[model samples]
Target chain A: AQSVTQLDSQVPVFEEAPVELRCNYSSSVSVYLFWYVQYPNQGLQLLLKYLSGSTLVKGINGFEAEFNKSQTSFHLRKPSVHISDTAEYFCAVRMRSKAAGNKLTFGGGTRVLVKP
Target chain B: GAGVSQSPSNKVTEKGKDVELRCDPISGHTALYWYRQSLGQGLEFLIYFQGNSAPDKSGLPSDRFSAERTGGSVSTLTIQRTQQEDSAVYLCASSLDRGSSGNTIYFGEGSWLTVV
Candidate 1:
């Protein structure tokens, strides 16, 4: 089984300012890391994912995340945020067990408030 | 190509009533998933269907929550005797088969269920 935790419940930042949302996970087996965003009244949209290879992965809307294996962390970052970026962010993990069938374990979410 | 779509975007039901939500996945996708998003629980995996078979239903909170996929296409999630605690956003997603390289899941807008 895998579990994810987003350290912050909410984060407020000025528009155009850099921001980071912290996430950590605990798993017995190797896992995949993902970051997703949810806008008001909308479904979750994949921001980025770290499956293998490079530790740093870039995603849409200038968002990026780094997968740190030893630390068990996958933190999402953005050089500059806009008002449109104010939404809920979730960190998730999926175990490598084929029997799980790609089921995801999600964090409690971090609400991003990009103030103008 | 059309993305995943869900019906009855908002549903309000009285306690002890029954509710049903629908989802249509992208064409040719063989994997479908259901999840629940609530204030306390955040995002949680509910069930998964590949082709016409469901290999995992362990995430379902109880027997009251049930889902079925037919013809390997559309799916319906039914909640019997819905309670106020069942009020949450029910999300549905599908992918072009998971665990393979470049496979990503797409989500629907989700059905908001508010039980009073």
Candidate 2:
């Protein structure tokens, strides 16, 4: 079975400050990783995804994540955040196999609170 | 629709009642998925449908939970005899196909269910 763990339940940061949301996963095989953001009263939007190739994957809103194979971690980072970045962020993992049914296991989510 | 669409953005039902949540995937998406988001459970996969293949129901919590995708486009998640524990956000997502590299899944706003 595969699982995702987000160490921080909430992260607070001021506008123009850098931030990082930690995510770790346990999987028996190679997996695809993703980050999603949900704003207040809105649907989830994809921030980025790591399928293959580069270890550092850049995403929308100037956000990025690095897939560390050794540590089994894919942490999201942003050089600076805005008030509009206040949202709930989720980390997810999917098994990279045809027999795996393409199911996604998600982390507990980290609420990013961007303050002015 | 341009993106995944879910109906009845918010639903309030009493315990022991039956509720149906609907999802409309992207026009050409061949894979659809259902997931539940709750304060206690975060986000969990419930079921998945890909083209005409048998749906993977392994993630369903119990027999009371069921889902169906008609014409490979619209999906409905039915929960019979709902309980307070069933109160959460039911999210739907779709992708072009499963088991492909760099398949990015898009999510709906989700149907918020409240059991009284």
Candidate 3:
């Protein structure tokens, strides 16, 4: 079974400040990683994904994440945040290859509150 | 629909009543999934359907939860004898899997279920 753990539950940051959300996973087999964001009262949207490429992945809304194989971590980062950036972020994992199912195992999620 | 669509954005029901949530995946997507999101539980996989294969029901919490995909396109999640613990946002997602090539799983806004 694949499990994802988000290190932080809430991140409070001022506008224009940098922020990072940490995520780690435990999986016996190769897996794909993803970051998703959900705004208040909205559905989740893909921020970025790490399938099998450069460890540094850039995503929408000026956000990015680095996938570290040794550390089993995928941490999301934003150079600067705005009030609109306040949202819930989730880290997810799925087994690689067709032999495994496509269900995504998600972390508990990190809620960001950007204050002006 | 242009994207994964779910019905009944919000629902309120008495404890012990049954409720059905619907999902319509993207036109050509072959993979569909159901997940539950609550305040503390985060996002939990409920079920998965890929093409004509057997639906992966491993994530369903208990016998009270079941889901089916009809004609390989639309899916319905049924919760029998719903309880307060079942109150959460039921999220539906779909994806066009391309093996190791990578693909994005799009999610619906989700159905907010409230059991009293």
- How does each model score on lDDT? 0.90, 0.93, 0.92
Q: Residue B10 lDDT in model 3?
A: 95
Of the true interface contacts, the fraction found in model 3 is 0.67
Model 1 lDDT tens row, B1-116: 49999989999999999999999999999989999999888998999888756447989999999998988999999999999999999999998875462467789999999999
DockQ (CA atoms), all models? 0.63, 0.71, 0.69
What is the per-residue lDDT of model 2 for residues A1-116, given as tens digits with 9 covering 90 to 100?
A: 89999999999999999999999999998899999999998878999999999999999999999999999999999999999999999999988885755888899999999999
Clashing pairs in 3: none
User: By TM-score, how accurate is candidate 2?
Assistant: 0.97
lDDT by residue (tens digit), candidate 1, A1-116: 78899999999999999999999999988888889999998999999999899999999999999999999999999999999999999998877665655787899999999999
DockQ (C-alpha) of model 2?
0.71
TM-score preference between candidates 1 and 2, better one: 2
Kindly report, for each predicted structure in the order presented, the TM-score of its chain A compared with the true chain A: 0.97, 0.98, 0.98
Which one is best on DockQ? 2
Question: In model 3 chain A, where is the ten-residue run with the lowest total lDDT?
Answer: A94-103
Q: What TM-score does each of the candidates earn?
A: 0.96, 0.97, 0.97
B1-116 in candidate 2: lDDT tens per residue?
69899999999999999999999999999999999988878888999898999999988999999999999899999999999999999999999884483598899999999999
Q: Give the least accurate 10-residue stretch of model 2 chain A, judged by summed lDDT.
A: A95-104
Best by lDDT: 2
